[model samples]
Target chain A: MKKDIAKLLQRKKKQIIDLWMKNQLADASLREDLMSNEELLEQSDELVNALLSKLTDDNLSNAESTDFDDVYEILSGISISRARQGFSPRETGVYIFSLKDALQEIVQQELRNDPVTLYEVSIKISKLIDSFGVVTFETFIKGREEVILRQTDEIAEISTPVIRVWDGIVALPIIGTLDSARTQVVMESLLQEIVDTGSGIAILDISGVPAVDSLVAQHLIKTVSATRLMGAECIISGIRPEIAQTVVHLGIDLSNIVTKSTLASALKHAFTLLQLEVRRKQKETSTLKSNI
Target chain B: MGHFLLVTIQVDLYDRLALNLEADLVQMVSKTGARGVLIDISAVSIVDSFMGRIIGNIANMTKIMDAETVVVGMQPAVAITLIELGLPLTGVHTALNVEKGMELLRKKILVDGEADNSDDEDQPGDGAE
Candidate 1:
């Protein structure tokens, strides 16, 4: 009976592919913009071939059997690629279940004379396809997570940049929350830049930071201490008014570290530390104006 | 190497090595009458609480001997670890590199010398003046 079912599926391979394609195209959620019809047909053909070529009586009821490895591999590949291509989970799920529908249709037609066999074969096909659906979703989610993780790493790498604002001074503008991990990155990069530039002063601009809490305050203190240990003065700037209120309320002592309300003031202080001044060309501009 | 004792810690310090360093550093300070001690720790990557305490102790000892202590070229990770360990090496001075450390030590010694000279001249029994 099992051999008969496998043989029946083998004989109707082309019919199964056509029926699956028709079912997918007929579905309202078909994503034509993301995938061309020919590409869809080619993917469906490959998956159908893998499934039918491996179908046997012994492995028909057990979806976890090794015989279905090729099918699972192809399904996961298609689903994962679809996930990266921005196909919705529903669309990917429909793509697989439609093939199940096609196989069921063929089995039902071939077993019309025997109701008992028809019921048994349909149940087996349903279980196998349901398991495939689960694998596809799993791979799809995994692919999406991979994309998210890569984006996070890239953000962390590019967010903490040390900018040299003067001959002996560097500035680092932090744009995110000051977590311990981010604080480590900020400290390492800032200290390394200070050494590279031989900057005696470092300005930490936190204008882009949204909030300041106790934990964040602790991380900031650690960074400042690390900078001081490197023999460079660390000036924290761009403290919002609310952040000031929060810091005071929390009773966190920032008295030892120089804190400025703006980057401009921080730069001015840094200039004074280096004994370097930025004066306007007042006399030259006045002479030119008088001549004109 | 001149008026200053330069110690470069090139390996991870254990308890015994750190203790030995503290004792030897004090002895050398008294023996050479060095005005400054510069500890270069750029090569030392790992540190523990015991090492941190030893560094603090060395700074304190050197300060008592009328010698300035400057820790130079401290790695960022090591600095953070030391800070988290609750040992800021408070009595110690710090510089970015060996050259800067030397400059700091020289300036400190020169200022102390000038202060001493001024104090001696202020006294009534100063024959050289």
Candidate 2:
């Protein structure tokens, strides 16, 4: 009976493909923009061929059996590719289940003469197709998750950038709220740059930071101390007046940390520590001197 | 290595071991008549509040004995932990390496020596003048 169903499917492959595409086209959730009709038909042809090649009487009861690996593989490939291509879950669901609808119609027509065997074989085939449809959605969701995970990794990579503002000085201007995870990244990158460049000073400009609570203050202190341990001095600059008040209201001890109200003053203080002098020369142009 | 004592802390110290080392370090400074002490702690990984206080105490004790102390080769993680523990390592001199610490200690001693010589020379000269 399995061989009979497989042979019937093998002989009417083109008809099955046409019926499956027709079923999909009839569904309102079909995503033609994500997948063209021609491409959808091509995918339909491949999945159907794989499914028929693996179909057998014993394996028809279960789609997860090793015997159905190739069919399952093709189904998952189509589902995941549809997900990445921005096809809706309903469209992907219809894509797999519609093929089952097409094949079932043919199976019922083929086994018309034998009632008992037809009931058993048709039920097994339905169960097998249902399992494969489920596998498709599972892989579909997984593919979407993969996209999210990659985007998250990319965000983490772009967030932290340690720039050298001057020789023997690197500036890390933190633009967001200071959290432990980001703090670890900031600490590692800062420490590595200090070691690599042998910089004597690091300026953590928090002007871009929106707020400074106790936890943030602690992370900042930890970073400062870590830079100091690497034989470099860290200056917490760009402390707005509100943050200063917050530090005082919380009674956090920042006396040991060299903090400046602005990055300019912090850079100036770093110059003093490095024994650097940046003196401006007299302007040569008469027009510039007159403006001054 | 000379009149200056070099103490490199290679082992990860538990509670009592660190406390004992602090006392021993001060004793050694006075016994050896060392002018300077450089403690290399680059190998010590974990430092808690207790160890932080011990370090502070070591620096304070050695200061009383008229010997300068420079902590050298502190790991970044240890420093961060110490700061988070609320011990900012105040009144403690730190250097990146032993050579830098020695140079700092020598410069400190030289500056002290210069002050002493000027004080001695100026007192009599100023009194006579």
Candidate 3:
């Protein structure tokens, strides 16, 4: 009977797992800090059992076989979880390669008497592990992308904050680049706050925004018109010198909407609209000395 | 329904309701000789181009009859939709709520009353009261 590489590996599962664990632990890039040694061993144990259980003579060389679905699923799960746990690509790549090294070493030992069988099985193991390596890398990238997408949504939610500055006045400070989706969020929040507070004046502070282009100006105009339609006055504040130059150069008509150079001025304008005034008491120091 | 007509739109505006409102509002204006119209649209959450145009028509009709129209309590989404529909509702006064709408309508009437008094012979009549 021709020597079966799958049966040979299956019979020596414990040795293969032991060697694989030793190979991974000895690697210089091994990150014991990110993952505990016990956890690593548990993960390696599950992967070895999954891989060996599905290994057969016919499908030993074919990594794309349906028999390897459980193997791939387990491998992808490890790769993605490791990726989220901050494992580098080099570390993950070394992990798969070390398992291949252990399997080949055992195969070489088992077929030392027959060189031809050993060489053929070694090539098959190399091709199979290489495919697993590709899967690991792909899943790692997908995992990182999911994290980035979630953070982006969080930033959008926290960035637009509508603060009630005074009676009948609200202030919304927009931080970051203004996109169409973000504009919709900002408009909805600002308008809702206006209704809730019964604020007649709304000051939009854009100092946190890095730059202003025509598209941004258009969004600002739309927001202003919407606020006006709600019977509230909208003030665009924090117009830097550069933004002013760009606005004038683009010939964007902000003539009808009120624009202020600073938030302080905008608040002052809001106060004026609400017919409110702020005054300091005179000679408080003299009264304090007389009381003493 | 006094010197001023208060129309509180409590339901979603359909074609027939909007048209009837326009006609009834105009008729009421001429019959009562009302000097102002305060429309409280706080409950309205949706507005289309037809609704926007109907509002403009109401404003115009009231203006021809020498009455001021003040739209009040418009929701933010409804406002954005109206603006996107290219109907800014210009030449129509706006206020935050019904109370503010009444104040705005009274101011407009007072201003127009003063203007009319100035145009004719000076009379010691406070027409707003």
Q: Residue A241 deviation, candidate 1, in Å?
A: 1.0
Candidate 1 per-residue lDDT, tens place, A135-156, comes to 9999999989988988878988
Which residue pairs collide, candidate 3? none
Interface RMSD of each: 1.0, 2.1, 0.8
C-alpha root-mean-square deviation, candidate 2: 7.0
Off by over 4 Å in 2: A1-14, A25-42, A56-68, A83-91, A107-135, A210-218, A240-256, A272-292, B1-32, B39-69, B74-93, B98-100, B103-129
What digit string (tens of lDDT, one per residue) describes model 2 on residues B1-129? Answer: 137889888988988889889989988987888878899988988777777778888888999888888888877666666665677688888877787787778767766766777654333221100
| Global Cα lDDT for candidate 3 | 0.88
Q: Give the local distance difference test score of model 2.
A: 0.81
Give TM-scores of the second chain, every candidate. 0.84, 0.85, 0.87
Model 3: per-residue Cα lDDT over A18-126, one tens digit each: 9999999999999989999999999999999999999987887798999999999999999999889988989999999999999999988999998988888889989
Clashing pairs in 1: none
lDDT of 1 at B7: 98
Point out the worst 10-residue segment of candidate 2 chain A by lDDT: A279-288
| Residue pairs that clash (backbone atoms under 3 angstroms), model 2 | none
Number of the top candidate by DockQ? 3
TM-score of 2: 0.68
- lDDT winner between 2 and 3, please give it: 3
lDDT by residue for model 2 (A44-68), tens:
8888888777766666676678987
Chain A TM-scores of each predicted structure, in the order given, are 0.87, 0.75, 0.84
